[model samples]
Target: MSRPNILIYMTDQEQAQVSFPEHPCLMPRTEQFAGEGVRFRNAYTVAAHCCPARASFMTGLYPSRHGVYNNVNTHTAIHRGLNDGVITFSELLSEAGYRMLFSGKWHISNHENPCDRGWEELIVSSPGDRQSGIPPTARWEEAAKVSNDTRGRGQILRPGWGHYLVYDTYPDQGPKGYENDRDYQFVTAAKEVLPDLTESDTPWCLYIGPNGPHDPFNIPERFADMYDPDQIALPPSYHDQMEDKPRIYQRQRSQYWDQLSEAEVRESIAHYWGYCTMMDEMFGEVLDALEASGAAENTLVLRMSDHGDYCGAHGLYCKGVPAFREAYHIPLMARWPKGIVQPGRDSDALISIMDIAPTLLDLADIGPIPEGVAGRSLTPFFNESSPTSWRDTLYTQFNGVELYYTQRMVQTQTHKYIYNGFDFDELYDLVQDPHELTNVSDRPEYQDIKQDLVRRMWRTALAEKDIISNPYATVAMAPWGPGIAFE
Candidate 1:
């Protein structure tokens, strides 16, 4: 069998439900792609932020091992980039004789050249003026030098309701021209480059990362007009009273979305939906290019987002420091027309972004997954047959890039436990409260469950080599617990 060419289509801050098969209104092309591929119902990002998530996506290692604790860009200088010692999937793919290409955001590290990590070709999307285009600092000390000061450039925060909004028409209006819009440029490059690469003898891998459906929710007027703000539906958890939720949740609401009236929240959600449709259109363009190139059959395609946005869920705007399902659970789909005999199935297996590297490497017939690679290969889940052995729980971690906070989470089929190192821990019974509106952690009845989850988190931390500093020497005891028996 001939080796397949790989195309990874990645978006920023996209929710799993936006492109879900049930809702084809927002991202029609993605829904169609899912119809021809397998959609992971419970896919998640190891970390909820940009740089850490992207680093895990590339290296197949958790943020703890990869060493990217936060977003790596102009603003975050303290933890700027991925460690140089880590090996990325691109590097291994390149070594395996595939032509590797990376376009769009490579926020992995402040490494001078991406070529060093294996992509021979790189086209960095300009982080437009609205995004501040704030250049990254040279070293860790520089972060303290300009604490919270975007180096004279302004922050991405807009004035109204703390939701970043630019109420303007599109096309050549901003510093980055509409024609030069990052997403447009990324698609244009892919359209122009894909045909030739498909025709080449060597199998090629192209990683396309587009910054979209994120915030600054400004989009072309056409898409912005798609949904009427009055008609937009609010998330069930939008008015989360913030009752049993942690202080961080309260602080985030006060800091960002507390002032937002119902109308403003609806309007923001409308803009977000519009932005999603616009991103879907861009994705359609690439699908058109692939079909035109006649390489659709031989190409293995992956579509996913780095993380999800709050989009008014829990009265929040962007991703919160806490482990909210809206922020961490994301869309993940894979399509290989020639290889996958039976597609259009949904797998409930718990998976993470870190799995992408190992899965892709496996699909490409690359040998022995690198030692210390922390993700499982998902190739087995492609077929129609169900695997007897699969993970019942999924774990994720979050640490602040701007604010130093530690949060680790372990989610089972029915429950979720979030340990906030600084404040209160959160335990949600998913079966009872799918929306995660209540926190049952402090309840005496659920102490056994919470204790078991805490032990799980500790074991996971040790397995992943995560550096979680816990003051309680109690956790140092048995793998299960003290006198408390694990149910």
Candidate 2:
């Protein structure tokens, strides 16, 4: 039997709920796709931000070990390298003779392109709006100049478009067009590569990473006007002010939300949904091409997001600041016609994006790459009728000066415990308060509960080596409350 071809379609900053309960955008296609696969309901990113989370997915390591801690202060070379001891799943697959192709965002390393990282073919954009200095392709340069004229910002000087400048040039192509922006470039590259797939007998892996719904909220006019701003429903956390929260949360909210109005927020959400829909349409195109090329039945299709966005959730505009559910939770769907046991099933098991590599390795019948990879394969969850003793807790971390303090959280089915290695600690009874509006860390009645949670968290930290702590010692800390203050 031949190894299954792999197609990973990843989106940037898409929330898990965007396609839930059949959202207006992408819901139809998403539902059709989910029917052919396993939909992981509880999947989350190891890190809330882009670079760290993406690096973790690529290398199957945590942010601490990967060393791509944050977005602004970190460089890709600091963590990922061609000669670095770390080996990516793509490299492993390529070494095994799979033809690898990558299109769209390559935020992992500035030291080398995806081709250097083992991809046979590569079409990637810069990490972020930081100017690449490497002149873009003719189409990209033309788009940049047009974008500059549209925004009156002199030139499209950024590597990727920034959020603050939404009134910029519009992207005409949906997913498969000749437009030279990152999204269209990815689609065009995929279309160009499709014919070759039909002639090749070797297993292939094509990564399509789209930069939609990330920022600038500027899609083609047709997609942008798909939804009316007045009809869009705001998130439950949408508020004018996030009172009784940490100072950092409040400051972030003020910085972004204070400048926009209720209508504008709705408009942004609508535009985001439109972008999502456009991406979904693009997915359809890719799938169609795969089927036309006779690779559909043998291809393992995976759809996921790097992290999540905060579309007016908790009075926040973007992601990376607040560790709320909207920012970390992501959708994960995988379809393998031959390998998957149960199709159209939804598993609520706790999973992380980092698990993708291990899962792929297992499907390809490859040996474990190394011992340092923190993620485990989720194949068992897909095969078993009922998963027993599956991961009981999910962990996430945010480490950067921008976040003010390094924070790690351990969440179980019933409770969530957060430790901000600085001044505050948070405990939430997820069963009772699903919204996580109340912090019960300081309550005297939950002292025993807090202690037990701390013990469990310490054990997890020690086992995962995610945090350095002595399990023998007990944590002695006061509870954070409404009156408690932080800088």
Candidate 3:
């Protein structure tokens, strides 16, 4: 084992497409970063939301196993924290004599910060806002106070009240405010600590999480100018009405995003692309710092996101209740000069954020992770020699975001099946409908495919001890039973 120094730079709500060499979101530096390593073209999040996916990266366990089915923040949350004694990879690495430094957003829990998991926390975002992100009940008077023109340009109204500012510039910060942006601060923290870690003899781990390319896409005027709305084309699937899918999906679209005009959607996408480029530029700084310290050869740098955002695909802005591919698929790239075999290569192997913990342990020769962990080591793919026996089917669990919906997704190379506990199921043949324009769940011809996918779903749920299989009569609403795990 090379025992490389680990550096992780994570961005929030980044789309998987951004990692592609031909993506419209022009990120030369990020592209350079990807070229220096292996890009897992098929990387995905265990869950779509922030906390649950981040938790999976930390523990290498599914949300059901970690007891964080949804956001663990101060927003309409069912759980405010993780289950007791959840072992994070950082804890193991710290014990293995690694200096753990964390900067930027730590959305895993309100009850505890990264410090609790053996990290030396620094310059983090929303560290201890013990309140839920969404309140259980809204103030009627405040809702009534919203401006009469709720769905006007730039601002959009919710299903009824509450105006949401979609995209705009920082009013008070002017054009240069981006210089002091929180993302800049996160990078600054990383730069400040890199020197000390480089000089130290002990191996170290540094995590930089920048909050960007998330909701609203509010960015600096300079960055926004990089993209033109007129030139930006909405995703081909953006016109999907979602009529063939569940009513909840339609309701989510019609209620929130429908208010935005097509032009506005294009503008939002432009802003999102600009945001990605901004983060990419900041990331280049960290890369520069690493090279300056002369530890680039032995450092394992992981550039990825907690999850992805739908930057106007299916008329959705942020990731949530919708069981769409845009929400689950995330950009994942890894670079370790001494450890990685094929530099600047891409692997289509199905990878999960949860795979990070186990892969790091494996490369460090830290040996077996705790029992019941779900992720497999990505060392084979890193070596450019993926074993023939690798998994062909990938599964994702999404209990909810801020809003609750029991959605389980099982995707194979050719098809995708989504079991929406709240509504009817959805199935899409990726070969025919890569954009997911149609739902063939009810087609008789697709019944065989649906059945096979459902059986696979139960296989993962049963293996992970996922409690969603409660078949106590009234709640056992899945089209297939847990018995399918055996059948």
lDDT of 3 by residue, 289-355 (tens): 9999989999999999988887678877677567678888999898988888978888888888989
- TM-score of structure candidate 2: 0.73
Local error of candidate 3 at 416, Å? 39
RMSD of each: 13.5, 14.0, 12.6
Candidate 1 per-residue lDDT, tens place, 1-487, comes to 6878899889998988887756634778888888998889899998878878988999899887888887555442457666657888998889899999878876777644467678865576532222455222122122223333221111222211111232333654343234556688877887789878877789999878889987767777677677888887789998787879777577556543555677777777777888888788788888899899888998889999999988788877667476888889999988999887689888888888999999889988887888778798887877554677877877787766442445678899989998664455689999999999999987899978887887677556545545443211111112122112111
Question: Residue 277 deviation, candidate 2, in Å?
Answer: 0.6
Query: Model 3 Cα displacement at 344 (Å)?
Result: 1.3
Order of quality (lDDT): 3, 1, 2
Quote each prediction's TM-score: 0.75, 0.73, 0.80
| Top-TM-score candidate index | 3
Stretches of candidate 2 exceeding 4 Å from the true structure: 72-83, 127-163, 166-181, 401-487
Q: Deviation in angstroms for 450 in model 1?
A: 39
Clash pairs, candidate 2, are 129-159
The sequence of per-residue lDDT tens digits that candidate 2 reaches over residues 171-279 is 5654433255568678778877978976988888999998876866667876777788788888777864656776657644443355566677787788788878878
- Evaluate residue 122 in candidate 1 and report its C-alpha lDDT on the 0 to 100 scale: 55
